[model samples]
Target: MTMYSVDVYSGSSDSIIQDSHAQAVIVKATQGTGYVNPKCNHQVELAKSLGKKLGYYHYAGGGDPVAEADYFIDNINGYIGTGMLIIDWEGYQNSAFGNTTWVRRFVDRVHDRTGVWCVIYVSESALAQVANCANDCGVWVAKYASMTWGSWTVPNMAVSSGAFKFITGWQYTGGDMDRSIWYLDEAAWDKFAKANVANPTPSPQPKVDQAKPVVNPQTTWTDNLGDTWHAEDGKFISNTALHLRWGARPSASTIAVLPAGSVIKYDAWSRGNEFVYVRQPRGNGYGYVAVRNAHTGEAYGRFE
Candidate 1:
């Protein structure tokens, strides 16, 4: 029997449950923003409970492509039985930031490190930008024309440098409502996984301070390890007891329990309230954190 897969922006627990017919699910995680929409770890746990093959998609954000790829690895390094790490490249332009040559190199780096197949997700227009390097990556073309959510097809877009023919999947609709079939089954996924190796001893990451793109002083960011600091001022701090609550009221929602040294980004202060809105930027999206416990004075310099 042909296996099927569903791709959804992370955080749509209900949608994934509704589309339980699919054998696998791809959760979208964008750079600079952090793991797509579903920001909670429990959401991931819920998806796995459905007994579906699980994977993640990184929404290709422009700018330092390598940095973006690293963000993805940081968040999803330990996820087990992950399928191909789909790189959704729809918004890419032909400009400097959208350079296909650089994009391909970044994709290679991610695949080399993750031990998973790297698939490209793009529309016709976006595909043109990466026409030259398309052959280096698998293709997941998105072509939608129907009025309803799940009815669409994968057009015969050009892949790599040749007449594009091999397409693994098609995204026929938008949002969590779309539906499609998988071109590869579990055995295929296993083969692809075996072909690649995981955690290929990443090249020494550049020191964040000495690195360019100088951190914005206005924005304070944090890493996955609860290491809090101001990216711009080059100040690092440690807060042993920081907790993140969802929503405005104290009782609204309680999300993550952050330990000391976790990296985070400063979002905003609740209107006239004492709590600051901080987020964990895992390249997918942002996770909310409270400022009450984030004020600890311990600090560190550029993360290596």
Candidate 2:
């Protein structure tokens, strides 16, 4: 059976947990070394009094991982074996945000002190940053369907945890309060909280390499550069520097210059403005990148 959870911070009111029917309530306990959630102890006690499963998290301030971990452990030492330990790895005010090694050190220290591996919480786009932490810590991804407020009704959405074999928890929606789904039962949740040994680390993935970028193959076109380009829609990795533009035309303003080994997932490609351009559906509008000099038949990068 699926389990529901709600995560809260100092800004959250007690009524959120009091009214939530979620099976688990993860309370934010501390941030960096200076700030502690004043409502943390009260929230944990409230969750326990209601006989709900409990969790506590530390907000990473991008400080020294060992020092932050020590602060988190010192405050939540009593709840180490009982509540799920989490490290909130967001970019807000976090200097070491995308540095996976910082995350590794913090969680490793938590395990050293409490013998409990803390789960890493990050956005779906930042999954690759924490790929190294998959072995010892669980992944808690936050990807909302919409910011709209709603009941505990699960949205019709499916998400991948990138290189990680599977996600331990998915926070699917957030507005007034954040909601998540856990695939495991109470026994599994407790096992993760109380795990004393490190899990076997998996083989590391290449630094810039990830899962296959292409989805479907349609047709092919040979450019003047003698490079065969696939026509179907999918991801494209630039072997060299390329300029992304606002329009498919050369006269269009340059949006951003993507460096070598940059990856862009395009929705479609078209031959226009003396160039072959890939259309990237981003946000509300689309961004276009010239993949080849269409008139000269010169390919800009390898197309898969």
Candidate 3:
């Protein structure tokens, strides 16, 4: 008897709990938002109560890869069941924010941080966009229906990528009528859990600076380098350094500078032994900024 599996999309009910006989259950969370379907918490708890092997599936939105990954981490962190994270790339066709590069990058980051095998769930169209990276990771091809053809035909889809045997599993249908049996049993779940380690370390948390008094809305300061600084909100530190070279460094980059009272929006901040780090607005692929001379800026008040 080959192992069989069933993937369930839990809406708001514990129907999966009733179908506890399935060897493995893939819980479908939200798609595109980069967050686990809010319905997953209920399903996860229900699956736990039923003692079933569980894996999570996220609908890929293909948008800003880092933001998507952060959304996933924020929602699904600390899930300790079968420990497999599945990325559903089937809906990439209409994604305004989705991109193949972002999808692959996000998956790589998630796998590196979580130590779980990130599986790609894609259809033939999506396959073309992400096929380059598919072999690098496990793939769950959605061939559906006997009418599909060529490599997309169920059997050929599994065999098209020689990296792995035809397919690890198949999704024959939706709901309780599914015909395939690729679900993982409890013993298999144990084996998978033991084989994969949760990332030994959790992702680093953002840091905050406490040494400097929060600058008020209208204050000015100068640095050793003679660069002027101004505080509008007492929370934002602005550089008034004149004649400063404009370019990107490991710490800071030149951006379109606003006037003295312009409002600056920052996502994170850090203070090191030598410098303070401010997250820069990403443009043209640049993502962060480091203020080499924090002494020049004054704050109106700490960002509320």
Scored by TM-score, the top model is 2
Q: Which ten residues in a row have the lowest lDDT in candidate 3?
A: 147-156
lDDT, candidate 3, 71-130, per-residue tens: 765677767345557776643233632354766787777766665656666543345556
**Each candidate: what lDDT?**
0.50, 0.74, 0.47
Residue-level lDDT for 260 in candidate 3? 46
Number of backbone-clashing residue pairs for each candidate, in the order shown: 27, 2, 23
Candidate 2 has which clashing residue pairs, if any?
Answer: 224-297, 225-297
Q: By TM-score, highest first, what's the ranking?
A: 2, 1, 3
- Displacement of residue 136 (Cα, Å) in model 2 is 1.7
Which parts of model 1 have CA positions greater than 4 angstroms off? 10-13, 33-40, 92-98, 147-165, 195-304
- Cα RMSD (angstroms) for every candidate in the order listed: 17.8, 13.4, 21.2
Runs in model 2 with CA error above 4 Å? 197-304
Q: Is candidate 1 or candidate 3 better by TM-score?
A: 1
lDDT of 3 at 114: 65
* Tens-digit per-residue lDDT, 137-253, candidate 2: 788887654333245765555556776777778887555568888866787777777868444232232232235442232355554544333344567788789888887767879
